[model samples]
Target: MSMANLSFLNVLKLDNNQFTGQIPLDLRRLDRIKEFSVTNNRLTGQVPALKKGSVSVDSYAGNLGLCGYPLPLCEGSTKKARTGVIIGAALGSAAIVALVVGGGMMFVMRKVVRKKKEDPDENKWARSIKGTKKIKEG
Candidate 1:
């Protein structure tokens, strides 16, 4: 019952089905496939490189896992995507840390400035007693 056994099939449309797993390589043997499609299926892995121009790019639509020609390149074929994600996460974390530290520094600085302003005579009493000497009582 393999699809290869149907060598005479000229048009095969298996779209919008619940089919899973890779598209059988045997289907490539169908030299007479003039119109083919497996869109909106759960098919995974690369689509067989059947006769060029025999299948449209839309034929693989909705198959997120399917790749190769007529579809997006597979995950292995692109490293920038993962690298970009990692870099983006790192930058986001760094930004958050900087904001927290900056906020803390600003709070502390404001408190110190406010204390100085509120106590303009702060240490004036200590300065007045700086030259005072302790006297022994008879």
Candidate 2:
């Protein structure tokens, strides 16, 4: 069987192939591409910066010679966990804040309801007396 030639705009998967060379800089020129990968190829070069930005690290995986953004550095693989922790922390904080604010709002609402229940007639009379308090006080 022969490999069929196909035109791809958003994806160009050639994973686990024997293709060798620097990944083309022009690969970044595919502006509409949101995901691009050449994992498990013999590609060699400084890694390409996405001109369009923000593809997943799995997009660069399993290649021997590719380096930068998503690769293990002298420091080691950090990006994946860092992103997950950041997103998790942010969501956790937001949940806490929502609970606090919602509780506070419920507390305020409960107070108003209790006050109304305690003195339903006071509200009506209080309104009447507001504009005439000085007159009544005199």
- Please tell me which predicted candidate would have the highest lDDT against the true structure: 1
- lDDT per residue, candidate 2, 4-36, as tens digits? 122236555677887788776656556556566
CA lDDT for candidate 2: 0.69
List model 1 lDDT by residue over 1-138, tens digit each. 898788778888998997999998777787777888998989998788776346878888888889978787777756877888999999999999999999999999999999888666787577667788889899
The alpha-carbon lDDT assigned to residue 15 of candidate 2 equals 77
Question: Any idea what lDDT model 1 has?
Answer: 0.84
> In model 2, which runs have C-alpha deviations exceeding 4 angstroms?
1-8, 72-138
CA lDDT, candidate 1, residue 1: 86
Supply candidate 2's per-residue lDDT for 40: 76
Query: Which regions of candidate 1 are displaced past 4 Å?
Result: 77-138
Quote the lDDT for 70 in model 1. 75
| lDDT by candidate, in order shown | 0.84, 0.69
